[model samples]
Target: MNLVPLDLDRDLELLHAWVTHPRSHFWGLQGADPQRVRAEYERIAADPHHHAWLGLDDDGTPLFLAETYDPAHSELAEHYPVRPGDLGMHVLVAPPTRQRSGVTSAVMRAVMDFCFAQPGVDRVVVEPDVRNEAIARKNAEVGFVEERHVTLRDKVARLSFCTRTAYAMSAPHLQPAAIAYAHRRLIAKAIAEFSHERLIEPIAEGTGRYRVGDLAFTARRYALNHWVVDADSLTGPLDALDFIAGLRETLGIPEKLLGTYLEEISATLAGTAWKVTHRRESAAELVHADFQTIEAAMTEGHPGFVANNGRIGFGLQDHEAFAPEAGRPVRLRWVAVRKDESLFVTAGDEREHYLAELGEPTLARYERQLRGHGLDPDDYRYLPVHPWQWEHKVTVTFAPDVARRSIVPLDEGPDRYRAQQSIRTFFNVDRPERHYVKTAIAVQNMGFLRGLSPKYMQATPPINEWVRQLVDGDEELRACGFGVLRELASIGYTGDAYHRTGTPGAYTKMLAALWRESPVPRLAAGERLATMASLLHRDRDGNALVSALIAASGRSAAEWVAAYFRAYLRPIVHCLLRHDLAFMPHGENLILVLENHVPRRVFMKDIGEEVAVMNDQPLPAEVERIRIDVTDEIKELALFTDVFDGFLRHLAGILASDGVLPEREFWALAGDCVRAHAKDHPELTGRLDLLRPTFKHSCLNRLQLRNTLQMVDLTDQAGSLIFAGELENPIAVFG
Candidate 1:
């Protein structure tokens, strides 16, 4: 059984049916209308003490309702002594289903499992109608001991309690079917992505089956244009580490890369296990949740990458506190760095602007802390550091700075932040309108050691300003509703001639921070924000987030697709054609501004690290560093490779798989968006033809497979690219 948060609005009708059924006389609602049901549940939803949930079977059918409440404030509290960790709950199984042996017991056990899973929940208390012998017996099966008789609002109930130990001893382990299902899905992803990258070859066995590693691995055709690895072929229970080990030789993995890659795979599996054990919200409910809540609740990381959630440096406890998937709030550790040894840059009025944003009282407190250490406030600046970095990397790796009094730890700031999808960047949850702080840490994830380069920080602000000015000056970009989230300021302190693990260029990136303009202040009235990654989000029930947004828009799926392409794709193509510019338009780098669930515009970010200019065109000397010389033949790859192959391919795949928009139609719409931009710019007619925008398939997995520790040589980014020949461009068919 799957236990999930109850979405009252979506499940109101079904709940009303269950509550008013003839067998549900104890529920006390026999003649209720839709309005009555809404009013009643809305009250419960508003109360901080009470919460409801729905349980579903493997097939996604709702089978029961479970309500949990704070027993300290509950009706049962008046009757029984409430312990510190006690929780009150009520359960209602759907009617008319045969009460077979172990059926009700199974549901009760699942409910108990969910309750105990919560932090600090040591015991669960329940009160069922005394006449309900069946429910009393079900509770006993799950280790609930009868405590006493209690009078609830409208019924006499048999009070029972189950301690955490009793529940753990009596409850069943996660069924083998569930474990097998998770393993099959993960294995399928590994095989499909590895095959697509041309790292491993799968032998077709005809009739929709394929074998890898001399038939040691078998895959069967599955939905969503992918295959499912058969769990039965494995000699024992499925283990991701063992499975990868078996395929290493066949995939031609080197010794070093293979070991690190296995570490990443292990981390990813651990994260998946935690999610499977704790997730309690259905896709439909998640789709309707508030924007930031949805961002934190996302289960999948990158759809294409196998070890996307590696989070190599994080310990198990750190993962819980800092990982975005954990959805926990973090308080960043602040430090004071000596200005004589640090670098600082700002875009706008630095003192007045920042002081106003971060209240004067806060700034004064930070400065006073510096004076307390006998350091002049004039010689120092504040720096925000990740808590985990302070504990692991900073305290140990940057010990010299600490010893020399160059870096002094300060008290934690008052604001609370949530780690965004990118582990280093944080969104200001305490004050939603504040700028996001992107900090530096030495952690290896997704093919790179994710650290902010001190030199890179120097050019970030100006590059963002240059891009912002370009967008502001272009009539086409304005017409297409393009905007930019600028990196307004940056600060860094690097130790001279530093080296860790004897790798060159890795040491100088140890300490740095930047503040990027938040999209919140720029949002127009009636417009809400969501990450572009939502387009690729598929819930556990196989419903796509984009599809849900389209439904909410009340527009036909095709209309929504056209609007998205116009807002997103057209701006990207125009930038490439007119300015020889491109951005890392990957899902995480762009934020979609939605008005009534219809995408209106997009804000581009990650400019310094990911944006590039691919021609010899003259630019301001200060910003000329953004330019990268590329062969004229592949310059258009700025668009075809970055936007199309990198981002649109996966989005189109998701939409097509869900039947929201056919695969052919999705590419056709993209082609139309590009052609429309080309037609609007007659001056660039010759340039467009020379830059025939067909994509070569760049193998992202190959980069990791070759060097999981540091996938790309940062100094030679373009030269480090690995490609698996070419794919027939999906949009080429349109031309």
Candidate 2:
């Protein structure tokens, strides 16, 4: 059903007939005429506190009348204390047209859905007449909890309310459907990723069916490149812990990693449950939303990593407020660090310039906070801290710094920031032009303690500035719109008293922050930005964001793929072969610049840590820290493993599964991009060709499977990779 804003002029007569009927006597409009209905609806349309909607069936026939109002401003004001998210609503279906069995119930559900769709509406308040037994029974069916009788303008009413959670439970279709969808998707990922990691060897039992560990543990082909583990294969219910326990011996996961991994898996499952329960938008609706909305709507966390959302320190409440999936804007907690114990670096701007961006009022307030503690504001540098870190880590773990007055906690900053897919990094939503603030939070997620190392902060701006200079000087890169959201400034608080070892530990990293330039200010007039991760996104309804983009671009899938390669893949290839440079160019690390939903350019981020100079290449003295000495044989996996197998392989599978493009065509396009880049730089032919053959498959899950607590060594990120037997490159066929 489509909800049309109540047309007071056109709907007056129809609305009068329905509300004045004996069935709608509780509505208190029984004796109302057309003029009276018009006056009432006109007043509703005029009032900001109230709204009326007409629900129409598929054939454009009016089926129901719904009214949504602010409980605080409406007739219910004095009767009850209105909550922040409470919205008053009433529903009346068109009188008995041959009384279909479930039609009334369905209409009620639709009305409630329409009401809850409005932002800030967490609960719906309804005050049906106390005498209306039928309406009361119908309300209870949808999870309404009756409180007490209350006197309204015209009649005594039963005050009832239905929370979002209550409605999700009472409305069976949503929870069951979401659970089935989430479970199927998660199971498919576990089977595929675990299999790829060689954690479980599956023997083919029959067509599209395979058995793993035991004959009873079986799975069938699921999506384009994944599998669905059968529920019946499990000894009992489909619990992730139980499933892992069953396969522990076969997979050879250590006792230490296994227990930590289970905690991660449990957290992942909990996140999925929250997402499924809270989601209201359909895939189509999400497709039409703005970039950030589409980003927040992405429910499938990662295509390959099964325990992708293991925010270990986050409980349910913390997850709801801080997780990127939660989509809630957060205010960052601020702190002042003494100058002697802190290091502040910037691209060109001074600390004062960055502070000015926080607005004069916020700057004054921060200064006042420092002065209140009898400290000079000039002697300290200000840094934003994650609220969770302040509550859990900084307060307890770094108590010495707090006690000595080296690190003084300040007030919350003015801007509302949104947690990007990388949880610690925050986008300034309150002022989009402001730089992104990346803070250190001592939390374990996706196999790493996600704390920013204070040691790395010294070289952060220099590394980014070097990359910016290279891109600016290169004609090809400049022409292709290759850009970086520079980590313009960084600050790390190193309290010597806290870490006696002189090496930065978890506690030392707890108070550091870096600010990167926002991509929003750099966007051209016609261009919009979306995270490249959206390419692999499939909504809860299994609709693809990439497919939607392709449709909106009005280009053939192959044409769109070619354009995307030219903009995204070609740049990475050029950098690797021509400059001996490699980036951790995974999906989340790249931002897609789209012009009318078509790929226009690319913005690479997370560069302070992920960008590296490969093959012992000499860089300038200041930026030489980025250089990593890897053998020539292992160098090419930068493109082959990270670009192809890491991201595009899964993308190709999804596009193929959705019938947007054939799997072969997708790789062929990728191969064509590499060939074109090689032909353009004939001097680098030998270097490029050496990387074309089959390479050892890089197993992402293997890293986490081996050590979920700390997946990779921060000191040597590349050395932490786990590799299995080689797989023939799909693009090799194109050559």
- Tens-digit lDDT string for candidate 1 (433-529): 8989998877788777778876668888988898999999999999988999999898887644373233556667768889998888887788888
The local distance difference test score of model 1 is: 0.76
- Candidate 2 deviant stretches above 4 angstroms: 1-177, 211-237
Question: What are the Cα lDDT values of the candidates?
Answer: 0.76, 0.78
lDDT of 2 by residue, 634-666 (tens): 678888778887888778777876888877788
Clashes of each: 0, 1
Maximum-TM-score candidate? 2
lDDT (C-alpha) at residue 2 in model 2: 77
Candidate 2: deviation at residue 373, Å? 2.9
